[model samples]
Target: MSEATGWPFWVMVVAFIAIGMGTSCMYLGAVATCAKNYGKGKHKGIMLAVPIAAFGLSGMWQSQLGTYVLYERKVDGSRGDVDVFRYFLFLGILLFVIGVIGTFALRIVDDEEEEYIDRTVEDLERSGLLEESEFFRPRHEIQAAYGTFNADAEEGSVTLSEEERQQRKRDLEREEEERRKKNWLLNYETRIFLQDPTMWWLAAGFFLVTGPGESFINNLGTVIPTLTPRSYAAAAPPAGLPSTHVTTIALTSTIARLLTGTLSDFFAPVETHLFPPIPEDRRRARLEAEQANRPTLSRMVFLLPSALILSCGYLLLSTPLPLIDPPLLHLTTALVGFGYGGAFSLTPIIISVVWGTENFATNWGIVAMMPALGAALWGVIYSTAYQRAVNSGSGFADGQCHGWSCYGLWAVTSTISVWIAVGVWLAAWRGWKKRGIVV
Candidate 1:
């Protein structure tokens, strides 16, 4: 249910624009509010805005596409899932726009001769800077080279005498010393942990499991007993019932984002409240100790637990609920959808946790490409197989129409997904082993 899953092209165009406008407005409004109250640079304004923008894009597109799918399926009985073009297009547009906007936005406050002033920020007197800055606000690209804006040191426009410079040099070195000690865990905090090999294997396993769960889990409606000419066991969902298939994934992911968003917001405050008065260093140490209990590597832990929930949900959906029109089949797909959303939301960022940010797009793109391909190819293989076997009378479920065709399709798709996952994990593991990141 990404724009990548494609709905109607015309409808999607409209959805994209509307979502973009709404998302931009909401983001800008919040940023404006933050600037008015707490100020933007230090208020996490950029970080907060980007994700919200992402939500609008995905949410609107998914809704539009889902509606179109429902309409199409009802009109012609097809789920008409499209390629991953929307994902790529939206992503490219997002990054390009952000990068461009950032470039220009920065130019609005541009300064060229300020190199002299800028130099005061990064250097400690020990590192041979001319003097310590009286203004302790940060100056270098606001965010630690890894993030967005950081407060710039605004050195008052004043010249210093030789004696003032020397004394300030001493002061700067002392300031640098205290700064380092104050946030000793800054590096560790900014960086994600990836010490264990087993965790990567777990991540790959999750990826493998999701391949099937994503593409064909809700698909049983179009499949399974559909193997028979019109197996009446599960009444064909009323005309437009199957249409939900179009937006099911998108809707599911949207819900997951909402849930994750709520939890993430809640936890931040809770953590801050619990350690309201703890010394910064001690709090850092304590947090590290807690995370040690559940290795950051095991972030896949969420996926593992969710996967089982999804499987059960899918199973239930497979069993028709008497009152439900499409049966629980469509609704239960939510479990799988949530898991996929969680994985989709987390995986790329998680990969960067170990691989570093040097080429994050390349690293994540490759991971994403494989699954996208797997889902797509597996889908066509499944669709075509069932069609052929049903026609030949040797397809699926003991030749009860074409059951085996679906099995054959799963067999091949699963095999391919497993191989892709294994290859990625092994390569990552070997790289880490040789690099000796563990030490």
Candidate 2:
């Protein structure tokens, strides 16, 4: 293997990155649903726990498999500081084939299935339930809101059991007929989520995420000590708790994700429940009665609490914890965890509303790239700053400056976070404006 094929180190990373990203996406979808379902008061927390807990436990298998493959390469002498085109080429081709097969094998909802689901839900609602059952669909169909609702309702019945069955069938037929008369696809509300608000916004967001991720993804592990550093030789957590580094990284991230996942569920209804026009039938009545209420901005009203928490977290995290003992440090880390978690939870809903989910997969995928870029940026920020400060030649090397890695990373992270916060507030304001709900 030559430089043309590049470092085997990089090849391995790319492969693992694909694996990591795919894993992350799987996790994101699962965890976010926990939030969505939980927020909507539909499902229990078990759905979210199954993935994280299972992943945490089963992680060893994937880890071992990954390690085994790498070790085999080493033993076979393919693991020099050089490249093995043959190895990577084979791996790449295998992955590509697997990808192709998996790609088309997936069946998104066809028109008929969607129509059937819509009608079923509408029937359930119109028969005086006053609302669709939150868990209308089973687990499998819940992804796209398609599934069965094994339910029936009625008052007391006289004799005539056979006639009652026939009559019930007739009632279902009547509901279907009524639903068919309404072509919901033409209904704008149904289509809102699918729309990508702005091409430039999505594109910018992607690069924003990717630039930092690519540039500095692994830097934090060195300074912050979290999860498994790409470099495994460092150390594992103590039996009592993971290593400081592992705990720092994993605890924050794990807690952040857990809390954020749930919080997003809490806020999702707000994101999707937008009937900006107040519905045509209710517009006049709402407007006439609305004059008495105090006018306020949506961003200020809706996001204020989360924003304040985020601000306090930001202000405090930069300062050292007055930890006489170890417990305070962990508690401080948890507070940081809350800030990070809240932002992660809220940002998606903001994006979903700002852009719509029409092309949301792509939209989110792009925006998601920003954190990567941010990480990358922080990596560069740390590495360069640390080197420069050490060489500044002012004899200013102090113990406080001994570990500037976290500080450097945080400097860049906090700066970017400020911008992200602004973007979030702007999104909320804009979302309300679009709906005529707030300024």
Candidate 3:
């Protein structure tokens, strides 16, 4: 397709559409699968983070390949044009092999396996060996304290009659049925999730925060040239400068994802009551007591710093210092990359924690769509600014404007957008707090 000059624009559009669809499906499927398999464990955050961090790191290697291996060399020893045909062929074969391997390797834990694991956990909890473990809550204590089990019975010696055992079995079956129902499309839980104001606020925050980062990435090549000295404006950008920034962003983004995922696991509050059998009046008190004792942080706390870091990047780009020495632009990308990567990684974990892994794909899909809108909005703003600068009679060469004026407006606009996102996230945080949701 890269070498087919006869192909129509519509054909190219269809090819792009196909690529986009496949990429989205594969990315979301991998994330949802990880969440389903590991979401109940203590390391759920890091488990989810691994695939997300991999997604960020992918850009680094791919860009490096395109720069160092897939490009033509000029007589002067500088890199020339890219070999788009070979690059496309390489990507196609690489993705095909990965897909083939994934088909055999990506198996979810089966129902029997999950049940056995649950039983083992219950046995350990009952044995009192896990009493000191923060991740496990003793089932026997919960049953006795909630009056589901006989309080008079001895701790490790409680027995159930045949009728009581049958009733307990029926209760478990009913709970399982309800859980399946909640996972169904357009169910009660889905309706509640859609109707919740907090969900929209969270989505809006993601849109505002991620859109600027997306735009910055898409425009990086163009923006870098703008920061070049007028004498060098007509010359090719410092060889590999843009690629270096791309790698920097990718690396920092990957690191941010890993760090945030691990930190969230360590600090975020754990849900104590998976299936609360108590009366509604007493449940709030129980939750309060559990939370007070645990004193875990909310996942929402991570978003504030992420947004601020992103805003700082935008603010830096809007300044004149980067034009004086364009290499200094690395700091901007690093900040934006860290903030962007952390926010993106945290979104899925938050959804899995608050809504649950069962409906995670649908919930995350809804939220994920917001970034495209944000990217388009910022992209347009950025293009308009660049075009205006190009036509400003500023002695810019090759239709490219030099200095801060070229990108300053878009950067300022993005900074404002990120701050607005911070406010939106705070609103979502308050909403979750009001409803006693940990995330």
Reference-based lDDT, each prediction: 0.45, 0.42, 0.77
Candidate 3 C-alpha error for residue 439, in Å: 2.0
Question: Where does candidate 3 clash, by residue pair?
Answer: none
Model 3 earns a TM-score of 0.79
Query: How far is 430's C-alpha from truth in model 2 (Å)?
Result: 4.7
TM-score of each: 0.44, 0.48, 0.79
Order candidates by lDDT, high to low.
3, 1, 2
Score residue 193 of candidate 2 by CA lDDT: 38
Estimate, for each residue in 195-295, the C-alpha lDDT of model 2 and write its tens digit.
Answer: 52433443343343324333322443333332222333333311112233234433454554455445434433323233222244455565455544534
Candidate 3, poorest ten consecutive residues by summed lDDT: 271-280
Model 2, residue 436: displacement in angstroms?
3.5
**Runs of candidate 1 exceeding 4 Å displacement:** 1-203, 217-240, 261-298, 313-326, 394-439
Scored by lDDT, the top model is 3
Instruction: Residues 341-383, candidate 3: write the lDDT tens digits.
Output: 9899998888777666656777888888887888999999999
